[model samples]
Target: MTAERPAVDPRWWGPPIGGVAFALAYPPVDLLPLALVGLWPFLWFLDKELENAPSGSWRGAFAGGYLFGLAQYGALLYWIAGLTGFSVMAVPAYVASVMVMAFNGALTAGGCALGRRFGIPVAVSFPLAWTGVEWLRSFGDLGFTWAVAGDVLANYPLLIQPAELGGVYLLSLWVVALSTAAWRLVRPRSDTPRTATAAMVVVVAAAVPAYGALRLDRLERQLEGWPTLRAAAIQPNVPQDMKWEEAFETEIHRRLSVLTLRVAPREPELVVWPESAVPSWLRYDPRTRALVPALAAQIEAPIFTGTNDADTLTGRSGREAGDYRVYNAAYLVRPDSIVSNRYAKQRLVPVAERVPFVPGMATGFFERLSAWTGQFSRGEEWTTWTVEGFEFGALICYESVFPSVSRALVLEGADFLLNITNDAWFGRTAAPYQHASHLSLRAVEHRVPFLRSANTGISGWVDPLGRWRERTPLYEPATVVADLPIPGGGTPYTRWGDWLPFACVLAWGGLALVGAARARTAPRGRGSVVASSTGR
Candidate 1:
């Protein structure tokens, strides 16, 4: 007699719960082996749950996927509440932001369900679908690409070098693949499963050390030609509530000027100020133009500061007037010439800066909410401005989270990554540290050095191998001046991005098709048979 199929216990929730718990303990203070093994439970859960399930169990798959996503995002971004003042008045805004994040969870669910139809293993399908969904979500009005899965691997520098070939998506693929393979080996099965699991192990074992060795070799080469330039970053600690107040505008400018001049003796080749360093609109103020140019002359190097601009045009009412538009722009100023290069922030913080819409919500409410002056236009493209012999791209505040935005700039011939942010709004929470972690991934992905200047903390530099060269203290007024060596050669990820994830998805789809065909032709009454053709 054939062995009876084992019953799925009510306790099956354990694996998913374990997975969720593991994801919560990230941005680790100390490296632990347990954290590396944390994702295995989730993969195991997916494998076991789907192993004998019906072919069209998309709903179950989607529900499971969504639950996992919700847990992951909710845990990681709980610090977002730190943005709200914790007053009774700020409760609505805090709750609203959490709800918006939950909505992004649905995308993860949808991707999983769609991939399941092809009979692909959750290990292969989950990462691919997740990567694809993230790529799609990053575009248009509803984009929020901050909490990507690969970000969990940011603390491990040695494991992240592969990003140069496939970007963060490739890292996500590797993570998922390994977790799934581990799950398969834990619950040994057929020869195909064993072979697949063994193959995955071989690939990872080979890849990890090869990447570590390559990074070590590259580090030696980079150090041999370290470029030293005196650079200064200005931090003007302005209170968030008083930032827009006319009374505090002068104080803001004075503080920035004082900071700039203090560092001028260092004779920096480039001096960078945080976003909106000058509180007043630059185009409207002649004094700003005159004074800034004079300061640039004193510094004897280009000074880049953030300010607003106004564009004059005829209104819809047929009256010619100047429309005041606020831009988070950067200006390159020198004594003889002021070269203005502006990159209006592409990604605005939701609710704090802009509001996202709910499907079927009233358009009138959205319109009314959007009538406020907080809205800013996104720049059409990225441009690299030259300073000395270097061409660096600028990412203002929230723009640093989106890799494609930075990648597009790199593709446009940017040599290094420069980010100017005001993390003062988030105060002394984990938000700034988390934000800094994301920047590290971008450096590894493009094989470029990243420099950041922030208002009230966490200003630093990241090397090509994703190492943090230097950083300022959190929630403090400080300047980080580093001699960063620019990397000329790009990695495989920069040359061919996201292809690895796409290939994994395609492979999963093909396997699912073959499994479906096999199941349809199999003899009946095999106890509702469901078998995965290949394993990890």
Candidate 2:
């Protein structure tokens, strides 16, 4: 017996339409309101695929999913191609990255099909399916946390309060929920009335912002009473190509010194510089070593700056023969001429920073390719730092995209978070602002303030309530000084990490058990019932 597929918008191009719409909801062309219903077309596509399920044509959904992903991630991550001036290698890098994310999209659609086979409603399974894969993509060495859908709402603090409860994944769940509700309202199921669907949407719309307004009001009052710590950030705005050249080194130092001294008048309790602010080994470069500490003494505040550091002064080999382990690190220089602590960036960018774990000749090929993109050893510690009485965690470069990184630091007793990044390579692309948006999610997730210093723009502070305090322009050199209120106590996200995705995985497991039993015991007539109920 063949399963009949719904003839509803079956053209393969439909997924791409959905994908482009979803991409528009994100940065550069950030039509934020589009996020509300962008996924409706995608959901419609998945529902059609579900109609043909159990008979195996449902597997076509995977391809449809990939098409959807290409439209979405391809546009969102196109800035990556601009990384190396859109060079020949950069083109392949961009294509490969999007293909991988598209594959994950295929998996998301396949998941919805699995739910269909088990006779679960599309509404019940689609969000879980989408979120489960999103959770998976954000882990291990292959993690690309930038793919999370909830991140689009970084500016809408109220819409994302669910993040404090479920991390960014919950915000994604919320987005999908709205999309599905919209889908139901437009094309009502046999059981769900259009008016009922409309009313439910209204309630969700009202309640979410209502919850956010209340939270923001309470946090504003508490912030007034809370103890504050004065902090300053330097935006060096160093050009990507010239930053590491010996000729520009002195100029880089001069600019940094000038900016630091400028902020010195503000008397900041602590100061931070963007990632790899000192392209050379800060401790090994004797002249710069003396210079940084002296500058710290001049300001009378501890200075936190990113540096490239090797294991030894003279490049001693590590575990591997004839190989030295270097790190992309953050160092705290105190006015007392003591280096308090150092934290290394754990998450390395794929291909650009570290080669991804692709087996065989591809590994060797990419390793050779990584020559253009120097690979540093991954850091192992979750170390937090203390400056006087204020404690903070330092996130180097793109590490802010990874939720687990900040959560781990907070668990280690960090009261605030700092992100130091060099977005010069992104070069005035939406990438820098997209990179900066992550702080809002991270800050709200743990109820901690996030202070960011970007080398070529987008430097600013995000308060514990997910509000942007001060945002600097791209390609501009500036210094931001502020007395931000510090926060204490753990948020639900900080305390119990990724519980929402885990719950979705468990639900899928439970559904699988039911599907297995039904396959053996249910009659052939039951298949018709499954197909008849599909929609949404």
Report clash pairs, candidate 1.
118-512, 164-493, 165-492, 165-493, 166-493
Candidate 2 lowest-lDDT run of ten: 312-321
Q: lDDT per residue, candidate 1, 1-536, as tens digits?
A: 99877586543464457445655545633233433466555455555555555453555545555555556666666666565552332446555544555544355444444455444545566666656666656666657777666777787788777777788777766665565556656654533457777887778757855886787686767665766455677766677777779888778778777888888777788888888777776656777777777888887877777766544556789787554444567766777766576666766665555555422121466646655414454456677888778788888887888877778888888888788888877777667777888887899888788888888767878877788988888756677676777766667767776676567556656776775676677654443224433322
Query: Top model by lDDT, which number?
Result: 2
Query: Deviation in angstroms for 131 in model 1?
Result: 3.3
Q: Model 1, stretches more than 4 Å misplaced? A: 1-12, 28-35, 86-118, 187-199, 202-206, 226-229, 313-324, 337-339, 356-364, 371-373, 513-536
Cα RMSD of all models vs. native, in order, equals 4.7, 3.8
Please estimate how well model 1 matches the true structure, expressed as its whole-model Cα lDDT. Answer: 0.67
lDDT of 2 by residue, 7-109 (tens): 7546676688888898888865668777877777777777666555543345678888899999999988988887666345687889988998887678877
